[model samples]
Target: MPELKLAIDAMGGDNGPSVVIEALINSLKQDTTTQFVVVGDEAILSSLFSQFELSDHPQVTLVHAEQVVEMTDKPGATMRQKPQSSMRVALDMHAHGEVDGVVSGGNTGALMAQAYFILKPIPGVLRPALMAALPNMTGGRSYLLDLGANPSCDSETLFQFGVMGSVAARVLESDKNVSVALLNMGEEELKGNDEVRNAAQLLGQSEHVNYIGFIEGNHLFSGRADVIVCDGFVGNIALKSCEGLATLIIDELKASLTSHWLYSWFFKFLQKRTKKSWQRLKPDHYNGASLIGLRGVVVKSHGSANATAFESAISHAIKEASHRLPEKIQDRVESVLLEQH
Candidate 1:
């Protein structure tokens, strides 16, 4: 296998370059075949390298970027004003083929805008969708797409999401027989608005996709479908709701367990089991979300991610780059579009 080189937006996250550098060092320890091009303030990054005694490391390189895109910056304005920002520089490297992929814990809107402008969408793809992996009830995972990318989408766009998501599931899950479904209010064919109903018809007609029809929100984690398709509006809400619910459950459990010692031994046992279960479902473990439909690979890390979370994001990018996920998605999209015509 060839060495996988990734461009990192070192100053994009809340913790700044320190977290990015630490994550890179940790990732390098586990994967020697990977190389990094850290984009940020050269002086600061260099000082950190010296402090970590990694100044002589063969696999890491530093690239200087003049500006940093803040999380609150407007996407369009940032793109125009901060062309030399670390986020833009990392993306530019991917566009120029200097890196296999780009990983960033930056403003989602700005990153998505820069990616679309620089890399552009794959041929026949109308728009790129943000795809994330969610742990399912079956101890496996499912791919959900269009998560806050485009708040609104047409029937054709939803169909395209299904194709891209199915390809993603195949690569990430290593399962060719992936079943797909559209997120709707009800499971009936006629439940959702015209957009979803139309998309369902298209998916059902797709010979290449195993379209399983409509799935309600309650079935998202049931593992009933490998791919769940929705517009960004609904997908984003669903994603955030799940995160909020998880936090509430964990906090409540902790309070309840420590409140009384009447069942101390049993509470301790339950706590241990609960902790293990929560670890498996931690957002940090699945921190990277792919901007699918782009010409090259791009993974978005959570803006507030820590070292462990950022490392997981980097690993996700490496996997997608190594697997050539964009190309796979492109092929699937073209085939599906051809069938539609």
Candidate 2:
């Protein structure tokens, strides 16, 4: 396989370069073929290098960046003012073809802003959507899109999300016949608002996507749809809610299991089973959200992600880069739009 070069914004996450470096160390253990350009403060990254004993690693290169984009900064204004920030520099490397992809555990809004400004949208795409691979029932995964990237979307934008999402599902799941659905209150044809209903009509008419009408919130993890399309506002709430609920359930189960002694062996077995199940539902396992419809690959990791979660985000970027996902999405979008015209 060809080696992939990725740029990392090491200073963006909550734990700063430490978590990024730790994740890099773990990632390198699994795949030594991948090279990384670590962008952050040279002094801090150097300290981490010594701490992690990767001072002479051939696959890692340090690029000094003077500024860091804070999580609280305004996306549009910050991207304009902080051109040389770690996050922006990493994205610049990918935009300039120095790296195959860029990964950053940074402010989602800033990341999206910078990506759109630098890479631009793929041909014929109106806007890029943030997409994440969520674990679904039947032990499969579903692709959910526009996770807080564009909070308000029109009918045409929603239709475009369906197109982009279908292409994404095909690439990620390796299933040409991917099922696409609009997230709404009910499955009735006239249930949702005008935007959703209009988008659903377009999706149903298009041969490019396997439109499955409407899917309720409960159906998100049911494996009934391979791709779920919605505006960023709804998608963000749904995703965060799922993450919170999953964490709460796991914690409650652990507490209950430890509080009992009569069923100690049974509790142990249940604990193990619950742990496995929770692992499947964990947010960290699905850490990367792709900013699809761009000319280059840019993956957004959760700002508070730990080493394991950060590594998962890196892996997601690698997969998207390896497959030339943006180009595929562009092609699909163009095809769908041409049919509409």
| Among all candidates shown, the one with the greatest lDDT | 1
- Report the C-alpha lDDT of model 2 over 1-341, residue by residue, as the tens digit: 67899999998978778999999999999987889999999999999998888888999999999999998999999777898899989988888899999999988889999999999999899889999988888888898988988899998999999999888778777655889999999999989899998998888889888888899999989989999999999999998998798789868876776776855667887768789777887778988888999999898998899999999999988888888898888888878878978
Question: How many angstroms is residue 180 displaced in model 2 relative to the true structure, after the best TM-score fit?
Answer: 0.6
- Clashing residue pairs found in predicted model 1: none
TM-score of 2: 0.93
TM-score of each: 0.95, 0.93
The residue-by-residue lDDT of candidate 1 on 1-341, one tens digit each, is: 77889999999989889999889989989988888999998999999999997788899999999999999999988888998999999999899899999999999999999999999999999989999988889988888998999999999999999988888878887656899999999997779899999999989888988999999999899999999999999999999998899789868877777787865666788768789887878888889999999999899999999999999999989988999999998888878877878
CA lDDT of 41 in candidate 2? 93
Candidate 1 residue spans exceeding 4 A from truth:
260-270
Error of 2 at 317 (Å): 0.5
Worst 10 residues of 2 by lDDT: 256-265
